[model samples]
Target chain A: MKHSHKKWVTLVFALSIVLMLGACKKKVAPPPPPPPPPPAAPTASLTANPSTIQKGQSTTLTWETQNATDVSIDGIGSVQPNGSQSVSPADSTTYHLVAKGAGGNQEATARVTVTQPPPPPPPQPTASEEDLFNQNVKDIYFDYDKYDVRADQQAALQADAAFLKQHPNTKVTIEGHCDERGSTEYNLALGDNRANAVKNALVQDGIAADSIKTISYGKEKPFCTEHNEQCWQQNRRAHFVYQK
Target chain B: MKRLLSVVISVFVFSVILCAQQDWIRTGTGLGVEKVRVAVPDFKLNNATPQNTALQKTFDDTLFYDLEHAGIFDMVSKSFMPTQVPGMPSDVNLAQWSSPPPSAAMLAFGNLGATGNNLAVQGWLYDLKNTANPQVLGKQYTDAATPEGARSIAHKFADEIIFRLGGGISGIAETKIVFVSSRSGHKEIWQMDYDGANQHQLTHLGSYALSPRISPDGSRVAFSGMTKNGWEILMYSQDLGRLVHFPHFGGTNLSPAWSPDGTHLAFSSSRTGDPEIYVTDSDGTGLKRLTSFAGPDVAPVWNPKTGGQIAWAERSQVTHLPQICIMGADGTNQQHVTDEGFAVSPSWSPNGQFLAFSWMRRFGPGEPGAQDIYVMDITTHTWAQLTHGEGRNDFPSWSPDSRHLVFQSSRSGQEEIWTMLADGTQQQQLTTSGSNYEPNWSWK
Candidate 1:
């Protein structure tokens, strides 16, 4: 009887151990829900199609962003996460894109270069300096309320001067403009200065001083009507028109 | 017997016209003091002729507007006046005029008429407080019977009344304001009476023109227009009835300001590769540069009283802000007059003791500022801001008498010309339709 009782006790202890091990294996601690994913760092990428173009042409910028709540570009304003825009920068320009997300922020960049095209057909006698400019040179851009020739714009002005020299009879008028930021009276004066700055550059590059005339439309005339830095940069420019 | 009776009536009218006195009395002259309560009833038409009735209506309206704009008067509205209008001094009841509702302290009554090519006006002012000597002023005016002559007669009488009652300052009742209007589908120079009547287009160049500046003698209007050859300074001679030759010396020439003597013209020109303040003979010869800074300098106005200094907008090198700067007529003694923010369009007061300009205290993008009118006492460099967070207010031009200023404001959606007393009271809009800007008050 004592042996039978001892056997029953040993059997019960083994069964209990097996039950406990099975319960522990089935639970497996649930893995802590994978740590909630850490919110996700935003990513942004921007690309310019036909990044190089002739003076009068334009380029398109396309962008794609991931995990972002807001997106904006350096010169352009607020934009959708995945969108595209067309821009006509007078000179080579670097555009920056920023993406903001719940986790962190990310940035990307793209560039567009304005390239000179081949010369036009043989210049006709009646062709004015304005005609020549329209056919060959691109307009010069400026910073807000500025008239000094930036270092990056020196090459274009040099090219314009060379073209003027190539056609000695041409008489060009530089129409200066503002970005619609200052008083009209002051903008008129600032536009006058911008045109003169381009004229000075042309004169320095061997163009005749008398060949250049200046006019200031101030903030009246604009090439791009969008209210953004990218567009305002295009409006603040010195456009060349040849005399008829 | 009929002829004798008519002769007696004629003698009576002539005697009243001849015997009236212009004795002026002052009540007070303190700034912001209580405005003199004055009532202006419609002038009675003498003889009841159709021409005389029409002239009387026009004259009465003109006189009322001028007195109301004087800023020293609390004008009693016509609707609040008694049913009886006193057309002569004898018809006036002092107690009625001084009664409440209007509670007028003074009254202006008149009789006016127009005969064959002639207009005659007899005007009188009475002070209710002085029952014994209530006649504060009396005047008689005679001119051509044309509509213009009627308005002129009223203006002259109103000026006389204001000069007598307004602490020795001359009135601007006869002044004119020339401004740019786009009402004709294109921007053109238009001139109007100071109270916004008689608005007539002065230029038919059929293109955009701006900044009309009348000469001190009112002979010509110098403005910048977009001609076929581009923007050039053109002069429309009021005397010649055609455009006179002002040199178009190439490059953008704009903002022509006449010197006090009308012998020299100051303008902004970029003919020298940069915009510089250039002063030339009135016809645009003998060019000399007045500003030699790196940035542009523009909008030059002469100190009409001194005629020795010119004030202008010069872009500051340190702050990149446009500041009001004053220099000698010979381009010497250059000094900065503004401290911060964007400042432009400096117009010197007629007395040369003050300068009125447009200033933006927080001028920039994404964070814009309010452009307001400010008058600075040149002697102390202290300023008083005249406008607050409304629309942009700019281009203040002083009246010939220096008692009022006409300017451009965008408060009514589109830009329009407005006027106010020199102390910044009595603000009245002078233009309603289309965009009008850059008002230049005539020298008168």
Candidate 2:
């Protein structure tokens, strides 16, 4: 009877060891609800198709993103979403995409290289208005609804200052701005703020304050959308004017 | 202002002579005088043009576009011409250049000043139709120390030629635009001449700032910005980066306007529930409320033409529909102008006879909430639509002369500033790139 009992204890102990081995095989908490599918990473992308853009040429950018209910572009000027974008990139142009899709967020990118507009078409006997107009246009942008000189605008501002410096005889008028989200009065003030922001910046960059003037149109102008920051973003900015 | 005027005159002269007339015009197209043809003398490289250089393209293109954009004269195509009009019409391309063919009438020429270093362009427009050799215009100037300035030189030259052609220089070639950017992730102002030359940034800080207004006096600016708390009216000195904010953080302050005297700041705020117009000292003192409304109101412009009359917009009933209103500086004689869909951003003309407001076309094809700019004759009470485009446009400010209104537009799917005649005629885009909105004309 003692021999039998000892045998039984050995058998129980062996069974316990087997169970411990199974437990140590893998660590995890009952597979944890499959982790709600990773918040879908807010599908985002920027594209510059016709990849090679000229210094002053327009290119089309197509951004396709899904899942995100909201989105915005970080440094590049105002852009609207779609399958195509007609962009004249003077500098490195990027299109920031923010979107939402069913599975989650997905992102994509398109690069654009403006390979210097074809040498003004060999100085045609007669020039095209687009060429001059493109050169005349100085693209700019602002933050949310504010019109202050953002740090990003420094390059363009300094370039403008340099132009003013060289021209010395040239005078430019600064126009302030605001997106379409605020009241007219508020936007006007914001526009003034934007214009003044530019004037202050230009003057500080060594352009004479007397040489630069300003104007404000509060939320009166919208470049892209009727409702989203995509469009409102364009509405907020400062512009300049130089006399003939 | 005097300095600006002198510069204008100089640039006008400098641009006319330097900017080359295109082949149609250089070759002579759009001459109105079908029989009138102009010759582009081969451009001589007073400074040699580098092969396949961006500057060369930029310089050559600058001259071509400036002349064509003027729309006053016709130009011949380069390919159509026997040889490239190398420099200016004065260069005399004895081989390919001719008169009386295609009814040529005038001659224009100029030179690219120097190479590697900044270039100076000089050109002249002559009416060949007149035996007197009518030397109509001439201009010369310096560009950026490098090839970059070639565009500016071209622009200046174009402006002069346009003036000579009697097209009235309002288009490219002479105008500078200022706006904001966040390439550095923070808001700051920037500016560039009429031609896209020399881009730079101003104000390098981590804080988010906004609303930059240039004073008619061209000495200072006013805007709404944050200083710790929320938003407030900040007056910035164009000469000194002096950000003077009102003593208190006004409720999300924005829409800053300068009184004709440049001593007062007319702005819009909601410190009292609904947004109301208010006036304050340029230094941020003497706060005075100017409007009372249950609904949102904003865009205050002190009329330089109307003798201190304050113009703005207010919502009398429903939030969606805003009515245009005007009152005195003291908030007297309150008057309502419209009972339409939605109206906001009231800008008074320098002459004060008109007020330009941003009007939204309630039902449109492209989108539901598309906006437009409108001009109201104070005496007639009739409204005129200034811009008609695919996308939305708002923020309309009239030129000092009141003949033109500058506004923001999203016609090309990008927000940009544009100018249109008060009659809504010549709608030209001011800002070509970037997202820019809210344009205010300067009395200066």
Candidate 3:
């Protein structure tokens, strides 16, 4: 038993030396881990969730993103960060969002969707002929200043596009929008340009000219509360509805 | 179940294809010019009394005059009605005239009535051919002490009518225009319509220019230019289109203004080795020192109502922001009124209660597009920002009536003209497409 104990002590001594030597070797050659990749700047991206908007009145194509360099919206709908586009699909419109850097580059494509809006409610018997327009229907909006479509709108926009493609008999109008950042006339023109741009895109996708129209409602309607950038984001967008 | 669901879906799809929408506007095919027609019937007495019949006619004519002056309508004579009227109709008969009076879609009409001391007017539009229900345009009652007095209420009615029509005013002969141009390449001076349509350059000589001014009476324009070299005070007469330069030996002389009485010009000069306020004659002589502080002071304007003071900017330090200071015309009781940031170009209201000035919050080499206009209540130390959002908006000049202001704004993707009310409402672009700058309003 004493002999066995002596052997155990010797083993312990050998194990301690092994551990010390191993630690010493690791300490001597410790190389830096390549300066930890500059804390990957707050991630910005565009995303669309449910991926769809209903038809009739203009619908808000919603989205989300993080670590955005800067966010801008184009083509009928406003944009949020992380590659999200607020699509107004009178029929079906696919909003192409290019998440860019300060130098204007495609950083990411978050939520790509073909939006289709559902048919509007039938006119009321008591409704004046102009009552449909009296809704003062303006463009749709997103969360304050955000152009990203959270997962909620993805499926909706795609279904909308497919439905519009199948129903080639219907015509649609795309309305561009902007928050109240600039002059009224200028904003209106900008909104028009955005809607026209989106309409042109839809034509590229085989939507006919006679079936699509464009308009701009510069900063006329907003869904958010307040005058800051957050609310402004919701105000800047393309809204889709029947041109009639 | 699958087959039944498919059939139901097919039916839904069929109806979706069946309900296509249509475009209904007449202009969708691009054929119509947006326009309105106005008709002034020979003034008829609506009431039994003829006491102010002549006055009523004048009043109705004035209302017609203001509407026509707005440039939104073609005034037509109802006496030339193409045919006998049927029943009264809503809206005006615009498209029926064979000669076609300007091809308008809307029309306005009115009637005048006179009672003992008062005159009442009622106006409506009638679709002469369809005369089923007429659209009433306006109605008003006023005192008819004089023919001209009777017309005053009509003018107000006309103004309201034009406003509701969404077309702006036009041919304001009483409203004078001011602008700046480098047409001769030296950034001299110019004036034109409030619309920036009829442009006329005011100065023609060698002057590196800035800060153009119009006197209280609109008879002349005063600006800072360098005729004799570095900088000098310059004045231009509306009648002769000639410039008279104010003189001083100094580092620089810029930002000229007229005394409330129009006899003297208050300006900034570095004559005492540093910029300070100076008062001189209209011909640029007899310079009297106004401020004692040894700082950069510039852009002086007299109080239109009180004539009790002049406002100018004073740089507190080399790195400190510029502040606006007001003092008596001779430079006593001087006190700092602005402390927010780099403020300049102080203009007083005709009522002497408020001052308008340009303030730059952030400083870069020259601050590319951040300058904005602000108004301050002298009695209440509070100020409000007028112009905002992208591009440089500065150099605010107030109208003689204190109703509106003309300012320089780089808003049209280029520097042009802008106008807004004194309370910072009804902001609109005044200049047509041009590279105009430095708007100075005239009291004429």
DockQ each: 0.39, 0.09, 0.00
Q: Scoring model 2 with DockQ, what do you get?
A: 0.09
> Ignoring the other chain, what TM-score does chain B have in each prediction?
0.87, 0.71, 0.62
Q: Show pairs that collide, candidate 1.
A: A129-A242, A130-A241, A130-A242
- Cα lDDT of model 3 by residue, A72-159, tens digit: 5556343546332334445655444444454344533433444454566887578432343334333434332222333454454344
For B328-397, candidate 1 gives per-residue lDDT tens digits of 9999999999968889988998867678999996777655678888877676676766677578899999
lDDT of 3 at B127: 40
The lDDT for every candidate, in the order shown, is 0.83, 0.60, 0.59
Ranking by DockQ: 1, 2, 3
Better of 1 and 2 by DockQ: 1
Better of 1 and 2 by lDDT: 1
The true-versus-predicted C-alpha distance at residue B181 of model 3, in Å, is 1.4
The worst-scoring run of ten residues by lDDT in candidate 1 chain B lies at B22-31
| Residue ranges of candidate 3 with Cα displaced over 4 Å | A1-244, B1-173, B245-250, B362-369, B432-434
- lDDT by residue for model 2 (A1-244), tens: 9999999999999999999988887664457555555545555666666788668777776665555564444444334444555767677654555555454544455556556454555554553333443465464687754444677877777776666676676666666667765344545545665676676677777877767656565554455547676776666777665545
How close to the true structure is residue A163 of candidate 2, measured as C-alpha lDDT?
62
